[model samples]
Structures are given as C-alpha cells and as structure tokens.
Target: MARKISAPSLFQLGYYWEAKIFLTSVKLDLYTPLAKGPKTAKNLAGLIEADTDALTRLLDALVSIGLLRREGDAYANIPELAEFLAKTSRFYMGELMLLQDAEWDHWGKLEDIIKTGKPTVQDNIFMNTPELGATVSKVLHRMAKRVAPALAEKIDLSDYKTLIDVGGGGGAFTIAFCQRYPHIKASLFDLPQTLKVAQENIAQAQLNHRIELIEGNFNTGPLPGTYDVVFASDILHYQTEAENAALVKRLYDATEPGGFIIIKDMFIDDDENEPGWNAVFSIHMMVYSEKGRCFQGKKIRDWMTQAGFDNIVEIEKNTILAGTKGV
Candidate 1:
C-alpha cells in the first residue's frame, strides 16, 4: 500500500520554493566565487550583479537548505557540494543544473501541455543546441561509467563475439563491455554529432581499433552487420511505442542465430502508476517530447513476442528486457 501524506508533507510537495532557489543559485554561479573564499551577500551581489538585498535572502535560504553555510558576515558553499556545484571544480555538474534551468520554463507549461496535449518545446536539447549536447554527453559518460560496470557485471558476455550498442551514447556501455570481455569487438552506433563524443571517448579508452563508430540515426537505420548481442539502452524512451516496436523487430532481425536482444530503460510496472520516478517522468515526456512516455514492461514483452523472439525474459524486472534468438 502507498503511504499517505500529512498536511505539511502535502504542502511541501506542492511547494517548489527550495528547488527554485537551488536552480537559481546554479544559474547565478554563486558557488564559483565562494569556492575561493567566503563572501558577504553584498560582495556576491557585486560579483554576480544581483541586487544586494534580494541576494541576501536567497543566500540565507540556501544556508537553511544546507547548500550554503553562513557565519558572522559571509556565506560559503558547503564543502561537499562545492566539488560539483562550483564552476571551476573539475567534477563540476553545473551543466546538468543548467539543463534543469532550461527545462524550468517548459515545466511551467505542464498545465497547458496536459490540457492541450502539445509539447512545450519543438526539439529536445540535443537537437536545438549541439554545443550543450556535446557537454551533456560528456557528463552522461562520466555518470554512466559508474552504472555500466554494474550492468556489465550482471550480463555474461564472455562468449559473445560481436556486439552492437544501438543508440549507444558516448560508448559507455560498449567501453565497459569491451573492457570486461577481451574477445568482444563492438560497434557504437548513434547520431553523427553524438558519435563524435563516442569517438573521443573510445580513443581515450584506447579501444579505437576494436570498436567501430557508426554514425547514423537508429530510427532510420539498416544497422550494419548481424551481431551476437544487440543492446539498446535508454533510447526507447525518446520514441513512440510503435517506433520502439519496429526498432525491436529490426534489432531482432539483426541478431545472429542464438544471439541476445537486450533493452535497458526506465520501465514502469503494468499499472504505470506505482513507480514514482517513472510516473513523474511520464509527465516529463508529455511536456518535452512529441511522442515519448514511460512504458510498461509488458509492452516490451509483447514487442519481443511479436518480433519472433524466443526465450524471452526480463532480466532486471522493469529495467532490462532480454530475449534470445532461437538457434
């Protein structure tokens, strides 16, 4: 059963005051200057060109939220957060925050989108801004490095000879798989611009000779070569169910005899209302995408069955849908 919310909790849920405060600070870049040393609100206002009186309240609010620390006359970024929040920090995640800031405007139209069933933005961030897409690709690569290793650990790829990562961004999973299994030669296929990031990442990993980078759109593709394993991760959410079904059929067709078809995505349960994150993400898609939304695991299971797959199984419940081609 789901937990019931109290009055205060419900109020807090409706209140986005603190979220806006943090995103606003990210936009202001207040952490960068504070990383050098603490500053009074007046000093910060002068640096970022914010109004002194208004900036003081925001800084105090940041302190209350534990993002900032205030003492005597100055405020500073919390030590742990400064590592990622500060613009000058090597581990900075300001880009991701900036991305949320960009979406802030779109999310405001959630009501209108719900009523009209129209997307707020014409194109996703990648299509509208190539430069930002490249930076986000790098950020995502760094994050996926932490996750792909675990996923690699889950799936046994020791016997798989050739693998294609359909819509693989920046070669994160491909790199992890190649590193885990020495005999595996892989293909990293994605859009032309996204593949540039993949090329740089593959070269850095020194697997350039082993992993061939293919530049094309997966939606309009005759993917090159049959493979022992065809893995699609985090790409299905961008397209419609029919599109994804067609994609799955294509992947199944491209699979070698006795090969595996793996699809990894944030999937909802049959109800599509139980998983909170995916439920919210459904609305996110409604606001941002023309034909994107979270799907049920059953949808993939049906697609797999329809595509003439055998030995179908969801290896990670809703997160990973896997099936084997009959020998």
Candidate 2:
C-alpha cells in the first residue's frame, strides 16, 4: 500500500474568513460590551444595535473561533479577548485590527501589484490623515509597551544618560526606557504630525518633562543631537539598502563614543526567503513602499560594521541588532 499525504494545508488559504470574522467583531464593538458581563445574543444585539438573528450567528462563530465563550445562550469574552480585545482594556488591539481592515482594500489588489510592480494605494496615507496616524501611533505604542520590559532587561542601559529615538512615532520605547531608568532623559524625533501623537502618549506616560519631542525627517535633515544611545524600531524597512547604509552612517556620527545604536525590525535571511512571516512582510513592504523590503541580518551587520560600529550583537532571534560605537 502506498502512503498517503494529506492536503489540510489548503484550508489555510481560506484563513481570510477567520480574519474577517474577528475584524467584523471588533468593528461591531462586540468585545467591549461583552467585557461588562456575559449577555444573551438577543440582549447583546439590543445593546450594540444589531439584528438579533444575525448577531446570534456571529456570536456563535466568535465562540467557535475561541475569541468568546458561550454558556447556553449567553456569550462572553475569553480571558485573552477580555484583556486584549476589549476597548476598556489598556492593551486593546482594536485600532490595529481596524487598520488591518482598511488595508484589506490594498491587499485585495495584490495581483495588480504583482503584475505591474506598483502599489495600488498611496504609501503615506496614514501620515496624510491625522486620525489614521493617531490610531496607528496608539497601536504601535501599545505594542512597544508589550515588548519594552523584556527589551530593557536584555540591554544594559545603566551607564547611558541621554538617548534619542529616531522615527519614534509615539514614544513608547522612550517612555519604557525612562520608566526603567528614571535618570535617563530621552528625545523623540519624528515628523511634526507624528510628534503630536507622541506628545500625547508621552504626556500620558508622565514623561513629558523627561522626553523632549523633536519634529523633523531624519531622512531629509540631520538628526537632532548626539546621544549616549540611539534607537530605531520598525522604521528601517521603509528605506532602501543604500538609504539605510547612509542613515546608519549618519547615526554612527551622531552616537557618542562608547555609546550604543540599537535597531529593531523584522529581518529576513540573507537569501530573502524562508521565515514565512518575514517573507509575507517583504511582500507587504513591496506593496506599501517604493524602496523598502525586509533586509537581511547580514546586510544590516555589514552596514553597522562599515559605519565603524563594533561589538554587534543580534538579539530576539535576529529581530533586533545592537552595535557599540568604539570609544
């Protein structure tokens, strides 16, 4: 008898249904209301102003998907959903989910992008819309908060006094570092409109007095000032290889002697293949940016070495790189 191979992987291709269900639930503000307590589908429909029959089915789907729990006719959020999906939770991910909902339009044109090698939507749409920018900034800030404590623990910043966050959209990492080391004052550099969002976040973190906001484009102009530490997260993938090399050189010159420059972004293998998530993100960069793509860790290391940085260290499974400036 011949061995048989299964094709259950084909079902993964239809995973968009799961995404749509979750996005729809978020758009309906379902989880937030459920955060209050369990409610029957009919009661939830009345509260969220939806048709009871339709909502019942949707609620059942949510329960099946493990985003919500069902007891008889009552539907309630699971613990994970209650914490991260509920709008009342500080870690709410609804804004990012909503942004992904908007990106569905661009993702729908993947075929056009593949054929023409051109983006169907404007790349700077977020920057052009204040509301969208703020939403994205808030989401990014929350994400940074989630990762910052572990990151701060990994890297020693005791000796560092001043820091600059290049293209630091909402000052999440800045606030985190400052909170971890109360003696460290930081500067956040970003676009004027982006800085507005960062200012609000920084003020909320109560680091307004410690974190100064600098409004400018690092690509077009010089960085604000020299610092003991320079950090850039999720920003380098927006530039070309040559541009990144140039930017690294500029950052090198701006780094104080014996200081550190840290970069955190999704990086692909040297072959630019494998790591399914990074490969998909490379495609996303192709559609969203003219010159951006997921760069290789080796190339980033080369850039840092060429810029006179030594003691380069790869951390977080190569998602982050830190280089030391020689004294």
Candidate 3:
C-alpha cells in the first residue's frame, strides 16, 4: 500500500499572527537583553519590565519560530538574531521591524484597497509624521551601511569625482562611497526633513565636508547640479513608468558628458512573473502609493538607451544597473 500524504498546511492566516508576535518582541526590546546571555522568564521580565508569564509565552513563541533558542528553562537569542535584532548591535534591524509594526495598521486596510483599487490613504502617514520619518531614516541608514560596501566593491569609482545621490536618504551610500574613495565628493538630494536626518548621519560618519545635503523635491524639478556619477537607489519604484522615464531623461541631462548613471532598484522581469519578491513588492507599491510599481529591467534599460546612454550593464543579479552617457 502507498503511504498516505498529509494535506498541505493551510495556516496562511497564521503568518500575520506570527509576525505580530515577532513585532511585539522587538517593540519590548526583548532581543537586546537576551544578547547579554541566556536568562529565565523572570529575569527577562525584570530586564524589560514585562509580566513574567506573558514574557515567557512570547519567548517560547519566538523560540518556536527559530528567532530565539531554548536550553532547559532559559531563553536566548540565536546568533543571527543577536547580531541583527539586538538594539545594541551595529546592524540592528529593530527600527525597521518597528516600522513594519507601525505599518500593521495600514496593511489592515488591504482588503479595502483590493476591492476599491485605490489606496486607502492619500499620503504616506509615516512620511507625514516627523518622528516616524526619523525612525525610517535611521533604519535606511543602517541598511545602507550593509549594502553600500558591496556596491562600492562592485562599481569602479576611480574616475568619478563628483556624485549626486538623488533621493538619497540618510546619506549611507554617499558616506560609504566617499570613505572608499577619498577623492570623491557627494551631494545628497532629498526633502528638507529627510536631509536633516541625512545631515546628522553624515556628521556622525565624519564625512560632513565631503557630503553636502541638498534639499529639493526631485519629482517636480530638475536636479541642481551636473555630476560625474548620478546614483539613485530604491527610488524608481515610487513613481509610475512615465514618471521614471521622465526622471531618467532629467538624470541624463544632469550627467556630465561621458559620466555614468546608476539605478539600483528591485527590477522585475519583463513578464513580471519570476522573482516572487518583486511581484509581491509591486502589490506593496500599489497599496502604498498611487502610481508606484516595480518596473521591468528591460524597459528601464530601453529608457536609458533612448536617453542616449551607452554600454548599459546589469550587475548584482539585475538589482543594480549602470549606463554611461556619450562623451
């Protein structure tokens, strides 16, 4: 007799419950304390000021989800969680996780968005809220610190002297590039409030002299200055296709003859079928913004070519694309 196959697990709704639990843990600053060492439920409760029984249950759930580990009656963060989830760690992701926690409210309106085919809110609440904006900026800065080093290694900046990081939040890429190439000077273009956060980060990096913060809305006007390298990372998905094309034309004009233009974003395939994350993110854009959606890499490349870019290359498995303007 053939072995019976169990029905596929259909705990789809459980994902949100699990996420809520994880977010609650991060909100309470549980992982940071666990980073010190293993501790019992009572000890953790005292450290984070939570109810002992309640905290223990949450810890047990985290352990089941593989975020924490249990040995006997003590609980501790897993190695990966300790490094990235602990508030004290350099690459701490608590702020980003908290941002998601805040988004839970927005996400709750997804059913309505799907039905109405429109965003429930007119503007991004997080951007409108100053405190939330600052938190988001800090998270972006930390994420950039992680990605920038790899980006610097992949791209050659020896010949590039001046760079314009359009819509550059937190100035993480600029700081990383400037540190890697001592001769490079970068200007970070963003809104006034975001530039404030970027300024603080640049000062902290001690690259204040090298990275200049320029305040403007790139969506409405042309870039302020010409640059040897124009870089925009994770900015394209926030606009419609026509807007991105127009922006690419503007970026081309901002680029010096023979200069380079680099666009780093989550680009989907032409069919928009493969790369599951890109597809899901396309929906995320739909729910978040009125016109934003992930664009096809081929379409973006075609736009570059039409704008007089030459020798375009896709790197980092199509996440980063670069093209050079004719001299």
Candidate 4:
C-alpha cells in the first residue's frame, strides 16, 4: 500500500509568523529606511525606537520570512518588498495592511457570522456610515494605485482609444495607461467619494486632460454612453453571480460594436485547491463584502458568454477576462 501523506505545519506556522512580520514591518516602516541602503542594527534601533536586542530579533525574524535580507551584520529590504511594502514607495502596501487588519478583525468573529448567516465588517466597525464607507473606499483606491500599475504593462491597451475603468480606485490604471499610450483617452467611474480621490490622483499624474472622472454606482446608476472598452478591475468579485451577469450584460450594451470588456479579480482553478491565493481570497471576500466570493475562470467565461460577449478568451493576461462585443 502507498504511504499516507501529510501536509506540513510549517506553512501554517509560517502564516502567523508572516502576519506578525507584515504587521510590524508596516508599523515601523522598516522597508523604507533600508530601501535607501543597507543599515546596521544600531541605526534601525534608533529609527524604530526599540532596543538593540529587540530590533535585532525583529530584523532577524523579518529576514527569516524573506521580507528583509541581511548582509553581514546589516539589514536591507528585499527589492520587491521595499517597493510594495515600504511607506515611502509609490506601491506601498502599508495602508493595505491596515485594511487587511480590519478585515481579519471581522474574521475573528466569523464563527458568529456563520451561525447567524449575517454579514459583519462594515457593520461592527467603520460605523456603517456613508462617510466612513467613503474613507475606506478611498483607501481601497489608494491600494489600486499601488498594485494595479505594475500589472498594467502586462496587458495590451494600445489598440483602444476610449476606455472606461469601472470601480477604478485612484484611477491608477488610467494614469498608467495614459502614460504608456498617449492616444488612449480614459474615463473612471465609481462612488462619488471614491471618484473624488480618483480625480485628484489623475490630476497629480498630470493626465487630467487624458481621463474623465465620473461618479455613479455601477449597479443602480446609468453607465456612460458607449466606449471602445469597459474595464472592471477588482470590481466584479463584490457582486453575486446574477449581479455580475447583469453588470456584464450592461457593460455589453454600453460598449460599442467590436468593443471589449475586461473583468479582473482573483480566481480559483478547476481542481479547487490550486493557486493558493484564490482560497485565501475567498475567505477574505466573505469577511469583507456582501455577496462577494472568489470564483473560477471557467465559470466566469460561461457568464461572459451568457452576457452576449464573443471572442471570450482567458489570455495570458493577469487575473482578468477579456472579450469583444459582436455587432
């Protein structure tokens, strides 16, 4: 008989360990200082306001988790981690760490949520107020500004002139695309408060002339007239299957013939266990938003087809579904 297999506990322990590291590193801005150059423990101790011994331990822990790299007795931030995790970098995930912490706080009470079949997050925290919701929405847009631009180049946006970025946080995709393809004019649509930040971000990028900012809830509000492409990044996962289908159909109607729609979000593989991010993201969606859940690309493809889109293909692009509308 074949030997019984077992999963490793290292990963579970590592998860908690990494959580601590991420929390602390973001708190101390460790990556930013070291991003300037490798620094000795003494320097970091002063910067973090901790004792040499405690700082050394924290640095070692971060190094062990691969968030930091040690050179001899000094420490340096890993390039990728420095760029994305450091507070000083444009791609900083520090605020996102706080958002993740907020989500995990709700996850701590998941047992009760499961028992009552009730939603949490915005209910227990954030006061369920429109203003607070707007604040969190801006934070999310800031997050999009940090993470989405890096992935922008991975897709081909050269062909389209007018594009609509649905739920575009901070208008990052539009900023990046405008910088790359000077001819591609873009529009961003989101909640009013969120659009406020998106407009500022676009202006800061000095691309205000290239992009338009519109405020409206995609589900209930009227979409702007036809465009060459409608791109939904980190937007669709927050809706139910039926709602996503409806929105896809709506996007199809709003798109001119031969135009395309892009749906980008996390997805699970058919086997259900592959690509670990999908599994974690599913739980995250449950804790964070109502009717949100990570899904499979195949199911999404079906939804696209049902919504009357053609040329549906899961290209080598980032976790996105791109398809064209037939005349």
Candidates 1 and 2 compared by lDDT, better number? 1
Give the winner by TM-score: 1 or 2.
1
| Candidates ranked, most accurate by TM-score first | 1, 2, 3, 4
Instruction: Tell me which of candidates 2 and 4 scores higher on TM-score.
Output: 2
For 97-181, candidate 2 gives per-residue lDDT tens digits of 8877877777888898899977665545345566787678878887888888788878889999999999898888888889988
Could you tell me every candidate's TM-score relative to the true structure? 0.94, 0.89, 0.88, 0.75
* lDDT, each prediction: 0.87, 0.84, 0.84, 0.76
Model 4, position 9: C-alpha lDDT score:
62
lDDT of 1 by residue, 1-327 (tens): 345789999988899898899999999999999999999999999999999999999998999999999878999878899999997887888888888787888888988988987787665556667678788788888788888988988999988999999988889999999999889999988877788999999999999988999887777766888999999998888778999899998998889999998999888877644664676677777776677788888888899899989888878877898999998
Candidate 3 ranges with C-alpha deviation above 4 Å: 1-9, 12-15, 46-49
Task: Give Cα distance to truth, residue 5, candidate 1, Å.
Answer: 1.9
TM-score, candidate number 3: 0.88
Best by TM-score: 1
Off by over 4 Å in 1: 1-3, 271-273
lDDT of 2 at 316: 67
TM-score of 4: 0.75
Regions more than 4 Å wrong, model 4: 1-11, 14-18, 28-85, 114-116, 122-160, 273-276
lDDT of 1 at 105: 82
How accurate locally is residue 141 in candidate 2, as Cα lDDT from 0 to 100? 81
CA error at residue 130 for candidate 4, angstroms: 7.1
Instruction: Give a tens-digit lDDT track for model 3, residues 280-318.
Output: 788877776666688878989988998788999988655
